[model samples]
Target: MPVEMKVLMNHIYEYQKGVRRMVLFTFNQKYEPAVVDRMRRLQLPFLLQPVGNGCLNLYFGRRECLDAVRMIVDKPLSRLTPEEDFILGAMLGYDLCAQCERYCERKCRRGHCGAAGA
Candidate 1:
């Protein structure tokens, strides 16, 4: 191969290597407790990088992506495969809102609801 082509290939390989090992999760400050509980229940390993205001950056091996994604979402943790890893799982979790802000007639915790609790 030409020198320029070799250099280009080497650059691409380096860039891919730089990103292959980083698996991280960022969570809202208020949900830290829930996130931590979820992680503990799953029993995965992590390095917690505490951000200000009770937020955190949880890092783990790339293999732990699915478990990390489950920690932040209101989902039942199912068996995970690499193809269905955290990069996409987190995106799917964001499609629905968390239960903390949700309200309905059945569990009317807010006064403005039409249920008995109103």
Candidate 2:
């Protein structure tokens, strides 16, 4: 996914209101201090969607869905596992995974995970 695409998609969804925003932060296997700071700074309502293979989704305001797009487009491949990266890319509207890959892909689609792949 490209940054331009992210911005464009976000612009389109920006008008929708009252929708709960979830931020999915995709992280590396190791915790990064900066990400913690970013999460703390987020003022809007949010829920953390952590990817098992180094990725997370930070849900925020109704319009914050765009942030998902932003994360996919902005984050580099080196930051996440192939599967996690593929899942994040899919979330941002870029489907890199073939149908078969879905089996291994992280379960971000469910919006949250209480147990492994839940």
Candidate 3:
């Protein structure tokens, strides 16, 4: 249910250790046949390179890059590419949680995944 809800974030909370390399949003699935072409028509800075097995790879060098793409689009989050998913995940603090493994939403401290060995 939460994944399908509206995500209000405008940026990704990247945790880069050194120089900020581009953030990679990997989608394990691909869009519909014409979706890539439609994205191109919008003409944002995103370069949606096609990955094997019907996946899509989006690379972003800065938050502004994503902002530009979002600005020119009016579709619902579900209809957007994997970028939306990354945004929502960052907003929800999916990177880590400070508590239980499966139920908590807080960002995990240290290297623990809140699932013990997980």
Report the number of the highest-lDDT candidate: 2
What TM-score does each of the candidates earn? Answer: 0.31, 0.28, 0.28
Q: Per-residue lDDT for 84-103 in model 3, tens only?
A: 44444453345534223322
Per-residue alpha-carbon lDDT of candidate 2 for residues 9-116, written as tens digits (9 for 90 to 100)? 363354234231333444453444444454456434444555556655443444455555456545444566545566554544444546226535444454443355
Best by TM-score: 1
Off by over 4 Å in 2: 1-25, 29-32, 63-118
The CA lDDT at 17 in model 2 is: 46
* Candidate 1 residue runs with Cα over 4 Å from true position: 1-22, 62-118
Clashing pairs in 3: 96-107, 96-108, 97-106, 97-108
The lDDT of each candidate is 0.45, 0.46, 0.41
Which has the higher TM-score value, candidate number 2 or candidate number 3?
A: 2
Tens-place lDDT digits, model 1, residues 1-118: 4453344344334434654343445555565565566556655444565655665655544445536455543332233322233334443332233322232422343245553464
